[model samples]
Target: MAVTRRQMLAGSGAAIVLSGAVDRLFAGTAEAAQAGGRSGYGPLVPDPAGVLDLPRGFRYTILSREGEPLRSGEGPVPSHFDGMAAFRSDGGRVRLVRNHENRVTAKYRVPAIERVTYDPQGLGGCTALEVTSGGRVLSERVAIAGTAVNCAGGPTPWGAWLTCEETEDRAGTNGYTRDHGFIFEVDPRGRRTDPEPLTAMGRFQHEAIAVDPRTGTVYETEDAFDKPFGLFYRFLPKRPRGGFGTLQAGGRLEALRVPGVPDLSAIQEPGTVFEHVEWVKVPDPLAAQTPVRLQDFGKGGITHAQKLEGCYWGGDRVYFVSSFARSRDGSAADHFGQVWSYEPSRRRLTLHVVFGPDTDVQAPGDSPDNICLAPQGGLMLCEDGDGAQHVFGVTRRGTVYPMARNRQNIGTDQAPAWGEFAGVTFSPDGRTMFVNVYEPGTTFAITGPW
Candidate 1:
């Protein structure tokens, strides 16, 4: 990634400029690498600051917090910071584009900026932050607005952020003027990306996306919590380039189907491989009446799973997360969580890991949402299950360990509540790790000895 400068800086003022830098592992950068080995930097130490408990030598600095007035006066930093990505910016700075997963009913929304605002009536969007390697946030602004449920997303090889909306609400619902549930491209370099939703991508309760740099083909997941659950999808674009606005040219939307496997949750064992997977075209990408997942796709309906979330492209393959599944919740099977990787070259998908029913919900191996690959070694998972929230690290040997815990108590002193961690990413240099606490919606830049 080249270091690019901002064309036009926007914001009320500069960031709070926190001190120090903390590092460990995050997805999508060489410095951060795919993952680490066993005994990852030792055990976790309780944080004295009562924000995030980190492993010994690691420290976190809050770059942007909810309810705090952004330097750009963009409505007190819209809350529910979800999925995010980091880029190499000009002058040794790391540019972050974060998603605010607010709904139309929320009080604070990503302020409607002139060119970047999509639908002023909607309440979810993304914000860009320019921060130095030392954890100093220099400038911030609204990268895109007017979208709903800006959830987890992936970074494009062409150096851009793909923000997904986790909603199927139409313009008539919730007083919205535009249809929800689509992916919006964002440029972190202060470049104005078209606010138009990439409708070519099938819409359904969207979760996250991962793009194959080799083919510019995008793999997407749906987080539908309904009776039939959601299906995994891939978009073959008309234009196969990583360049900005390339996805707007329209594409063919399809769902993955395994011969005998109809539901992904049925696969219980790790290392279980599905070969010769077929892609079934979706009848309705617009979801005008029947959702993409509901559309009929021939003999055996397309494959579906429960709570499919975080996604990232790493090691010549695409990895995704299934937060959790329960038969009581209408799933085919039950498990705490599952991580799977797909190899495009071989057209194969493998169950990399599956959390068993006996797994501890609060443990590092529990339910994982947003995920990132560590260039140096192991994969990082953002905790999203019961008990205390944490950022878990998985070693190359398949061992799971806690890397960071949410210490910020959101509830009363009698009963503390910590928000789940989201958007685990690292700068190009891998000197810093960027993540967010979903509740109270604070973005942290942690730097330490990797």
Candidate 2:
């Protein structure tokens, strides 16, 4: 049975009836419905701080700024802060493990230590920041170093951040001495440990990851914008809940497939659901020469999407973002982005939201990157498109509304230097939310009524 917009607006009960035993993860809220039905968190107001503009009644605190010396005295905080995750610490403080999306040519690099460094020449990794419950920064230090393009990753149920590299740059290339494109674990509590790449997770252009807490299965997304695109993958660990090194020891990597659907481009349409999906094992998890998506394509059992990014686990499904997919590599019929929800229990994937192509920043077609389940019971998305970027709130009824915007300017010229919002996540207690501005690299702690 196919789910429709009308059915979604009818309520969660109707959704349950229509989809059988499948859970209605995105059921609409009364507050969302009251705000003109399907409209977002209301209009965004200008910021007095000259950094971010938020909705009325909401305020932001700049926790960490880029180009400053680290609190731990390693070096200046690395720039290009990308994906991040928040965790509760011992003394009413929150710990954040942030990714630095730097490459070999980056001017700054996170200082590398012998034990935790993967490749000294690799200029990307993660940093740990400790902040009080009141949003005051306590300390900052390099958590994992000597990696390439540490883009986005997720927190494990066992309490650690899985930092992913969004690069396929191999060893001996671009001044790199070791292989790139792997995920590394970092302890959020600033514990000392060796950094090891989980080779069994399948090396590719890893964009983001979401682990199913119930199964300990890690679902990964790849960001490949060029031909052959990327595949949605899952790593089944050898042991369900082993210590830190379980993923590194070994695992089976598989790609998602929708039984009879040869190509998944049909998912570009809103509310399209692919039922009864299956997994195709990768011939070589570590594709040293060939990419993993290509390996899945050669086997003829897997389907791929263009530029898969930003995924999170919520309710009983894994919600993932596909940033701008087209019929062909350069086709005009391109979707700015599409949000898909995958139900592991039922082995199904549903296209929850699809954005049409529109150049207007305020339009509904804005490309979405990072995503998280809102404490108010919906989804919060980080816009990564042309012109001004925004953080959009999608209600259970599928209405999109702007929640925050970047109003940072360039020098005295007053030219807008729009920065894409990344690493949107709420604190464990849900009292605060943490997000990052891609350029100039700033982390903000936002608090307000939901």
Candidate 3:
């Protein structure tokens, strides 16, 4: 396949021009619908099957679901689908490396394949799928297995997925054979998957990561709740651009430290910039005794944010999310969500967007997580909040609209059940947009007139 603009952007760490995505994020409900009260492909029409609701001229294909047998003959597809990425394959097919956020007690654990299991007693991992540009599933298999809480992660410029563990389960706990919260690399092609945890990267409740393709400097996020809230981190690898196993070579893991700021949520305004940011070395990346967040950072303490999630590389900066924050949850401030961008060159961190605390929970664009730059233009954010679930879109004009909704009522007439939309991404060919519903695990390939 020919190299596309997205590929080039990934290779060079080109900056993503958000085109006012930040401004639109917290836009008032009145201004949000300024563009005919809809943008992109227009308002979403309800899905007839009661699955995924999409805009007119758009449709979705359920590629796989929980409890289904894999086309590759591996065991059933694992439950709790989360983060995902698409890679160009040899033929016209696209490769997907999807994560399953199964806990230690999950009923449907990811099955081992090609002898690539991380820990026998662990219950979470990732699966690989090969599909056509039109959303046909050609094959499915386990890419990595026996890890735990494989939540959201980011894609690599070298064409791979960095699956993160959102737990810090220690050895001997709940039948765990080894320490559980480190990042692992998975090659969707089923070649070069390193079963060993990238130990140099600190062990913690890792939510996501973004690799600067140019320098291989990894920006990581810890999603722990306040018992010492999570900190933003980076792993400076020894061998920068080396493909799969390069992370095993070792690197330095450090947490972000914004001079006078200890809690990031205190900043309520967008465009709040902190300059000359520093990184403190993690005392114990393995966290043998004390968790990384609990470790001492001395006089200049590290910066912390609640629910740090969804990481991606745009242009020369690394963008990440704080799913949501509440003062009642011990946060310094409260807000619906926040998106931050860090510039290595400037050694600066800026609050790019801040969702309103009053955003209608049942409406579009609340608690955005697992974000991605939509191939067509603008940004796509998965809704992980109360009320109805939707995949919200921000058009170039800074108008926010509901691009898709989860109409799957897994509950009942009185208590309708639904899952948060996650892992929103597009194929290299940009023909389909793939996303996951967390509960009852499902993957959907949404195609529409972009």
The worst-scoring run of ten residues by lDDT in candidate 2 lies at 13-22
The 0-to-1 C-alpha lDDT of every candidate, in the order given, reads 0.79, 0.76, 0.81
The window of 10 residues in a row where model 3 has the poorest summed lDDT is 11-20
> Count of backbone clashes for each model?
23, 1, 3
> Which lDDT tens digits does candidate 2 get at residues 21-119?
112445322233234224444566767676787767789998887788999898888989899999989788999999999987676788886667889
Q: Which stretches of model 3 miss by more than 4 angstroms? A: 1-38, 358-364
User: What's every prediction's RMSD, in angstroms?
Assistant: 9.2, 6.4, 7.9
Give the alpha carbon lDDT tens digit for every residue of 1-450 in model 3.
343332233223222223223643332122323332235556567566878877778888999999999887888888999999989997779899999999866878998654899888888999999998777898899899989999988888888799999999887988888889999999989888989989998899999998887899999999976648999999999998868798899999999999988888898777788888999999999998899998998998788899999888877788889988889988888877888888899998888777765433222346788888765556788988765677877655555666777888778888776798889998887668899999878999988666
- Per-residue alpha-carbon lDDT of candidate 1 for residues 1-450, written as tens digits (9 for 90 to 100): 221111000011111111111112223444433233444665567666778877767888999988888878656889899999999988899999999999866767888887987887888899999998888889888889899999988889899899999999998899888889999999998674889989989777888998898899999989877778888889999999769988899989989998899889998877788887989999989998987877889997788899999888775777787889999998888888877777788889888666766544333435789988765666677987655777767655455666777888888877666788999998888678899999889999988876
> Residue 159 of candidate 3: its Cα lDDT?
85
What value does the lDDT take at residue 404 in candidate 1?
79
Best by lDDT: 3
340 Cα displacement, candidate 1 (Å): 1.2
